[model samples]
Target: MSDEKSKLLQMVRDGKISVEEGAELLDAMDEPGTKPSGAEKELKDRFLRVHVDSAEAKVNVNIPLSLLKVASRLGNMIAGLIPGEARREMAGRGLDLSKIDFEELMNLINQGLEDGKLVDVDIEDPVKGRIRVEIYVE
Candidate 1:
């Protein structure tokens, strides 16, 4: 491999640069004179995509939601211990359990796929709707 390519690969392996970032660099290297491909350009906004594969009655949420809930509870406790606007901000934000539609999740997944990043998802029972979903940085 070329020196630059090797460097990028090493960074990805070392967790310094993400797979999406490495893909963009590779695209740029492949097209030395011209601009990056549309996929490469969009990688800047890339995010991991999660989807629920079950029907409306059996929506499965990502496992991370439980962890997020725990983290939020811990954050609330910490905010109580601290003082000032940080606590207020945490209170205002609440649990931040807002849900995103499947379309948005699909868009993020497609973007990640286009940019050559690993996309992961899970299916689980729903809390209120047919399905639950989550996404993250890859």
Candidate 2:
């Protein structure tokens, strides 16, 4: 326990500062040391991370930004094309596909759509997995 830390803790305990204020004080103290260290840069240069799965053999596929736009457009089109019940369902869920950024996710759905395995698609905001697309078969 450094003298300064002990004093800060005492002040917090004595109600001179709130716990949140104490946290902010500690964070403020860190600002002077926030500069990037050269060693960190060197380490980053030496190491890169790649994600992989063993179950499904990886297949390379390129999805253009244009494709995303097209998918979004298609979703909108289907939203209009469907009957009221389907549209209401889509509207209730608020499907929006642009939120899905994981290449694997896109590839899986896209492949499913092409293969007839998926009859519908729904899109949503990425964070909450919101519905963004609704696909249907004739």
RMSD list, candidates in order: 17.4, 20.9
The sequence of per-residue lDDT tens digits that candidate 2 reaches over residues 110-131 is 4433322222534333343433
Q: Can you list the residue pairs that collide in candidate 1?
A: 56-130, 59-131, 60-124
CA deviation > 4 Å runs, candidate 2:
1-69, 89-105, 109-114, 120-138
Following a full C-alpha superposition, what root-mean-square deviation does model 1 have from the true structure?
Answer: 17.4
Residue 86, model 1: lDDT of 28
Q: Report every candidate's CA lDDT.
A: 0.37, 0.35
The TM-score values for the models, in the order shown, are 0.25, 0.23
User: Please, what are the lDDT tens digits per residue for candidate 1 over residues 1-138?
Assistant: 654456557746865444875576566556644332464344334333233333432222221211221222222222232223322333354522223243354455445434332323232324422222333443
Candidate 1 Cα outliers beyond 4 Å, as residue runs: 34-138
